[model samples]
Target: MSAPRFGRITAGPAAPAGGEALSELLAGGGARVVRIASRGQVDPEGAWYDQAEDEFVLLLRGAARLGFADGTERSLAPGDWAVIPAHCRHRVAWTDPAGETLWFAVHLPPA
Candidate 1:
């Protein structure tokens, strides 16, 4: 077995201009944990994500908004979370531009 690992999720490279920075923290048994840093990022018009895995998203800092294909929207602040089912179309509607918005996401294989 491998030794355990530990680190700060908030400690990472900055998000690129007009883009987000993604760090894969762990992956095994068809599941993955990721840390995402964003600043003033949003999906392009008509763009959406349809993932094969279910996603659990937790907002750790700043604020954000998520838009669904069904014309619904959800706002998120620090400490807020949401679970997105596989193939559920969604997009990043907005993110705080003044500072970094950190997100912790766990992706698990669809049931």
Candidate 2:
């Protein structure tokens, strides 16, 4: 059977890990869509880049910070959204403990 193509609001269980949390809303075909809940317990390790797809992230709940390759940092809170271009090196730097960091991440084919 083929997967249904449409729009909806889907929620799933929390991710199991220490660094990042992810609950996939859709995982099929050429796409792996998910909602990310993160708590930056520590700075990210090493330099990382996404060559296959650009990541689109939206802060759905909680507060956090992001560090980029250019050494620039930004604090994020609920209702904030950003798009990280493909192949960009970046990392999570910090987060608030009062609440669990929740964000939506949609990965798309690279330009």
Candidate 3:
């Protein structure tokens, strides 16, 4: 079998002007990895993420704001990492409008 390719995590083209792009990097055995490119995209009104698996996410570049159901918010800068437990309600409150925000998210031990 061919070996898996390992390369720059910051690869890929820029996200569109005002939309967010998500690409699955890996997935197997109840776990998955995804890369997100955001250009000022925010979670829709009253929408929340109730993921089935725990997620460990890192802000690769740019900045973002994450919001929880408890009404607290977290601002993320490059190199910031967050581990969110499964079932915790959360959302992307905001992202950098002037530039692209890159994210690496890994879902652990699926639901």
Candidate 4:
């Protein structure tokens, strides 16, 4: 038997000339792993992410800002991470516009 293949997470779609770029790395068992490439992409006006599952996001490159429903916000740099509980209302406030901002997201069912 052969071992599973190895893939680079940094490999993503071509530079988004318009909107944000997204790629799913894995999905199963009530969980999903997604890679998001951003260049100043933010949640639409008056929009928020009210996911049914918890999410953990890691900043692999560039910088970003997260806004919570409670008015609190978080700034993330490379190597930073944030865990958002299920049903927590939040939205992306900012992403580095000068270069690529890569994010690794893990969505899991509630505990």
lDDT of 1: 0.94
lDDT of 1 at 32: 98
**Candidate lDDT (C-alpha), each:** 0.94, 0.70, 0.91, 0.86
Task: Put down candidate 2 lDDT per residue, 12-86, tens digits, no spaces.
Answer: 445334456666777655566787765544465665554577888888877888788888888888889888887
Output the better candidate (2/4) by lDDT: 4
CA displacement after TM-score superposition, residue 7 of candidate 3 (Å): 2.7
Worst 10 residues of 3 by lDDT: 5-14
Question: Using lDDT as the measure, what is the rank order of every candidate, best first?
Answer: 1, 3, 4, 2
- Candidate 1 Cα errors over 4 Å, as ranges: none
Candidate 4 lDDT over residue span 1-111, tens digit each:
857866888888744633478888888898999999888787875689999999999999988999988988899999999999999999988888788889999999666
Best-performing candidate as measured by TM-score:
1
TM-score of 4: 0.90
Error of 1 at 34 (Å): 0.2
Q: Kindly give the number of clashing pairs for every candidate.
A: 0, 0, 0, 0
Model 2 pairs in collision: none
List, residue by residue over 26-100, the lDDT tens digit for candidate 3.
888989999989998888867999988899999999999999999999999999999999999999999998999
Q: What is the C-alpha RMSD of each candidate to the true structure, in Å?
A: 0.8, 3.2, 1.3, 1.8
